[model samples]
Target: MSAIELEKDGGLWTVTLNRPDKANSLTRAMLEELADIAEAAVDARVLILTGRGRVFSAGADLDEAKAGLALSPVWERLSGAIAALPGLSIAALNGTLAGGAMGMALACDLRIAVPGAKFFYPVMKLGFLPQPSDPARMAALVGPSRAKLILMGGQKIEAPEALQMGLVDRIVEGEALLDTARGIAADTLTAKPEIATGIKRLCQG
Candidate 1:
């Protein structure tokens, strides 16, 4: 199966992590596939991110993590490319999100987490610092102090707690996450596309 699956239903394109057995841990091929999809998504009105398994994503693939020997440059650059996609991006968190997985969700413009899903950004847990942009992105969403608490403590927050901390826009039933994200995307299509793109660009800037 393709590590990354793209579903196009009219103006919306959903990119799904297809490695259910691996908790959708990002393999090198998956990352590159996503980047290519992002480039191809410019014409789409909305882009949805989710996973095939119950767990949205466990994190990076350990076998492929050795690629960092070259300085992890590919991961950072590909991540920015996906997160900065011009179309509206939404993450439907069906289960646990940790490590680099947290970065993936935070990259989305809005995130809807399922009842049992949890979130943690534990770069420090690996004894490596977060990418410079990771902190800035976190600060933009949840502010400095809360971001600092997460980064410093490497604490994992449950769904309700994640909502309180502004990590997710809403908490929904596990079965409803994908439906809710698609509904939001349909709603976005009702607005003027240029205006929406402009606002998103401004926020990214």
Candidate 2:
């Protein structure tokens, strides 16, 4: 099966991280596929990113790290693609989010996660810089103080704390996570397209 899956319903497109056995850790192939999906989703009015199982993404595949391959460039490209989407972007984090994958989530306009989900960015503790786009995006979402707590302090923030810190927009439990995201997407449809797109781009910056 593919490491990434794309499903479209009308103008809503969902991009799923499908490597459940590996906690949806990203591989080169997966990153490439995601970038392609993002690039090809111009017709989508709303894009939702989520994981297939209990974990959103554990970040880069350690095998790639061990092989001495540079994954930063690929991550940069992928995050940039998601950020550049003309319409609204939503991240439906079904479970925990950590490491490099946090960048992709931060790129989204809104983040809705399950109650069991946790958020962490451990790059500094792992002795590496996060993807270039991560820090600013993280700071934008939760402010510089909270961003430092996660990125530099390597704090493991649970759902409640995450919501308090503004790391996640909403915490809906179980199947309600996706349902709520779809509802938000439907609400966005009521806005004027050009106005919504313009406001979205402005907020993204």
Candidate 3:
């Protein structure tokens, strides 16, 4: 099966991370596929990123990392592709999102996560530095102090705490996560394309 799955429902397109057995960990092939999908999805009115199982993504595959592969550049390209998408972007976080996987959610314009979902950034613990742009982007949403607590202190933020810190835009109950995301996607699709794009551009700038 493909590592990523794409589906279009009206104007909303969903890109799902499908490697459930690995907690949806990202591999080089998956990263390339994600970038390609994001680039091709610009025409959709909204794009929702989600995962198939209890973990949104476990981050880069360890085997790839141990073999001397640098995944940050690939992640940067994927995040950039998502950010540049003209359509409204939403990260429908299904469960745990950790390490480099945080970048995917950060790149989205909006985020809706299940109540028990967890967010973690362990680059410091892993003896790696986050991409230069990551800290700034996170700080923009949750201020510099909290960003440092997360990145430097390696604190794990649960959904409620994440909501309070503005790391996630909204919190929905377990089974209702995708529905809430679809509702938001519907709202975004209702707006004029140019207006939505302009608002996103304004907010990001």
Candidate 4:
């Protein structure tokens, strides 16, 4: 099976990390495919990123990381693509988000995670830097010190704390996760494309 899956329903594009057995851990190819999808999502009115199982993503596949995927530029490329999308981008995290996988989630315009989700970025422990935009994006949501707590202190933030800190916009039950994301996207999905994107641009400003 493909490690990544893409589904389109009108102007809503849903991207899923499909490797449940691997905890959705990413490899170089998976990262590249995700980047490609995000880059191509410019016409989408709303884009939702999610995973198939209990873990959103465990970050880089360990064997691939040991082979140098940890520092790959594709990570930055994928996150950048997501950030640059003209439409609303949402990370509907199904479960725990850890290590480099944090980059893509951080780049989304909003993040809503399952109540059981945990957040962490352990670059300090792994001896690697986060993707170029991750620190700034994360700091923008949760503040620099909290960003440091996760990146430098290796702290794992539970869902409620993450919500309080603004890292995640909402904590949703597993079954309701996608429905909630879709509901949030409902307005954008129905609005005129230019109006939706214009508001997004204004908000980014």
Candidate 5:
């Protein structure tokens, strides 16, 4: 089966990390594919990132990371593509988000996760720095010290705490996760393209 799945429903593009057995841990090929999808999503009015099963992603595949995927530029490329999207981007985290997987979610315009989800980035203990834009994007959402607590201190944050810290925008029930994300995208999906894109641009400013 494909590790990544892309579904296009008109201007609403949903990207799903599909390797549930692997906790959807990203591989180089998966990362590249995700980057490609993001880059090609320019015409999308809304993009929703989510995963199957009980975990969004556990970051790089261990074997691949041992071979240097940990420092690959594709991570940055994928996140950058998502961040540069003119449309609204939402990370509907299905479950825990850990390690480098944090980058893509951090780049999204809004993040909403299930109540059981946990958030952590353990680059410090793993002896690798986060993707180029991760720290800044993370800090922009959660303040420097909190970003430090997760990155430097390697503290795992629960969904409620994540929302309180401004990391996640909302905590939703597992069943309602994707529905909520879709609801949030409804306005963007129906708005005139230029108007939606303009609001996104202005907010980023």
Candidate 6:
């Protein structure tokens, strides 16, 4: 199967990160596919982003990253494109989420994290910055100090702590994450499509 799969269900477009053996770490080709999906829209009422097996995304694929960061540019553009999609978008964090992958979650309108899963960004530990937009997005959600602490600390937090820190909008059992995400996406998608995109963009500002 493709590393990333886009499935249309009625009005919902479920984007699954399908690299189970690699913990769903997205690649350059995957980014291209996602970009195409975002640009098309094509009657998607809602978009749910999730992962296969156990991970939403374990950030970059270390091997590919070491091989000169294969899909960095594509992913950067794709992440921004997904953020501005017309459909309601929700992140379904099934397991460990980190790095640029966490940026993907931040781009979503809402995040539903499975309980006990770890949420963190350790870019600072690697002597690099979080994605340019990450701090601002995270800060908007959890406030500045919390964002600084979490991102700078470079330490992982469990679901309960992540909730306390406002990193997760909702928490559910792993088995329930997709259902919760779809319910949220469906509820939000009830709004007029154009209005949904406009309001979401303004709120992001």
lDDT of every model, 2 decimals: 0.80, 0.86, 0.88, 0.94, 0.95, 0.79
Work out the TM-score per prediction.
0.91, 0.94, 0.95, 0.98, 0.99, 0.89
- lDDT by residue for model 5 (6-50), tens: 999999999999999999999999999999999999989999999
Runs off by more than 4 Å, candidate 3 = none
lDDT of 1 at 192: 86
77-146 per-residue lDDT for model 2 (tens digits): 8889888888889999999998988888988889999999988888877678888899998888789998
Clashes of each: 0, 0, 0, 0, 0, 0
Off by over 4 Å in 2: 202-205
Model 3 Cα lDDT, one tens digit per residue, 62-177: 89866644444888888888878998899999999998888878988898899889998898888888866678879988999999999998899999999999999998876888
Candidate 2 Cα deviation (angstroms), residue 72? 3.2
Error of 5 at 57 (Å): 0.5
Q: List all candidate RMSDs to the true structure.
A: 2.0, 1.6, 1.3, 0.7, 0.6, 2.1
User: Which residue runs does candidate 1 get wrong by more than 4 Å?
Assistant: 67-71, 201-205
**How many clashes show up in model 3?**
0
Q: Which pairs of residues collide in model 4? A: none
**In model 4, where do residues sit more than 4 Å from their true spots?**
none
Model 5 ranges with Cα > 4 A deviation:
none
Estimate, for each residue in 116-169, the C-alpha lDDT of model 4 and write its tens digit: 999988887878888889999999998999999999999999999999999999
- 59, model 3: CA deviation in Å? 0.5
Q: What is the lDDT for 115 in model 2?
A: 91
lDDT of 3: 0.88
Q: List the pairs of residues colliding in candidate 1.
A: none
lDDT minimum window of 10 residues, candidate 3 = 65-74
